[model samples]
Target: MSTYRLFDRRFIRHLAVLVSATVLCFSAAAQNVLRVATEGTYPPWSFKDAQGQLQGWDVDIANAICEKLKMKCEIAAQDWDGIIPGLLAQKYDAIVASMAITEERKKRVDFTNKYKSTISRFVAHKGTSPDVSPGALKGKTIGVQRGSIQAGYLTANYKDSDVKFYDTPQAAELDLVAGRVDYILGNMVTYYVGFMKRPEAKDFEFIGPNLQGGLLGDGNGIAVRKNSPELLAKLNGALAAIMADGTYDRITAKYFPFKLM
Candidate 1:
């Protein structure tokens, strides 16, 4: 072969290999990663550990789902108020933030069947005894996480009460410990396992009946963008696979003493 033609062929071959590798890398990146968002402030459900790594039931479950789907999972913390918006904006592919499904939220997103069902409860300072009757609680200040289902329920039902909103349930619980709010309602498992078990929260106790159903929400599920039905179906299948293969129970027992499903 002539030197010029030989060099030209080698260059073309090298260029073709480079382009092929680049295309494979891009394809693998696009097809292999699953991005998940969680509220790191919500402990036992999802939270950062001492090392700032995301850990908790929701985190574990999300990992299991990704494993079952054979996807590389990336979990990031997002503020609770913006979790839904974050998914819609494509900041992440899904939310495993213990987001309870509600009709209003359904308009904006799709959800998998619940991974864990939780009861809601109202907490108050132990030293304080207040009537939990609707009329009595209506007159007392209530604390709630802003933008939560509990907040919506409280607002709709307790129109006469002073509602103090916090960015996180932990923050609201702190205010209750400080006597800032008469009572606060939230996920029972969150308060029972994450809050009431803490030494600082020794003065707090669950009051009122266990709350759920209606506007308070039935259970927590994974949230995906409304437009992403294929992704949603993949998540749902992965969720089911985890449930049937005993991975779900193993993860639940690692976090909670009781059955969560």
Candidate 2:
């Protein structure tokens, strides 16, 4: 072969090796990217704005955790019903949605330490002054989001009541406003952010004592796949760090008037 042709061939081989090394580097970097899923319909915790961008307490917290862990992060919006299944399918590395840490869910995915506690309450139209006890609420209509702890609680405790399950909290709240349901049970933070603060919801008031402990699960937690112990631990550590360093508090204060921890 001509000397010039031999030089060109050697240069091409060097370029090919360089391109292969670059591709491998990129693949390794991509592996470090953590994709987190959140139900962007649950406000105060997760929700989308008019512009269709996700923004809420959970979104901020997730970003903070990613910052602390020094990991490349991407947040994906998923419907509430598909969040868990999507996680199991490896569509995302973690679920930062305000998913309660319950025994039933634990069977499907491991959860990190409780990040925030949740309280459920019964909201009803003002002047009704309806009693909140199971016996008192019997024969009355109650709205709750389907597949939620609140739904499970009502189903288990208020079998006599006419319980209506909705796909989203907004739907339940709408039914309550329309007089289709006498009351609705949901997270206090969500109620306040999504409904209570609105002019239309001014007529609705929390009529019952706050519900917690049993059936509500311990608290809200980050859910990871069953086999991701290391990822879980790292997230837990990042959460603790954010809480200790006051990053968590700062984020919470922006969306909530009180501490969630």
C-alpha lDDT of all candidate models, in order = 0.87, 0.91
Off by over 4 Å in 1: 1-27, 127-131
Top candidate by lDDT? 2
lDDT of 2 by residue, 1-261 (tens): 999999999999999999999999997896678899998888878888999999999999999999998888899999888899999998999999999988889999999999999988999988766569999988999999988999989999999999999999999988888889999999988887779988879888988787887788899999999988789889999999999999999998998888886
Q: Candidate 2: how many backbone clashes?
A: 0
TM-score, cand. 2 vs. native: 0.88
Q: Model 1 scores what on Cα lDDT? A: 0.87
In model 2, which regions exceed 4 Å deviation?
A: 1-27
C-alpha TM-scores of all predictions:
0.88, 0.88
Per candidate, the number of residue pairs that clash is 0, 0
Worst 10 residues of 2 by lDDT: 125-134
lDDT (10s digit) by residue, model 1, range 150-260: 999898988888999999998888888888888988998888788888898877788877778889777888999887889888988998898899999999889889897
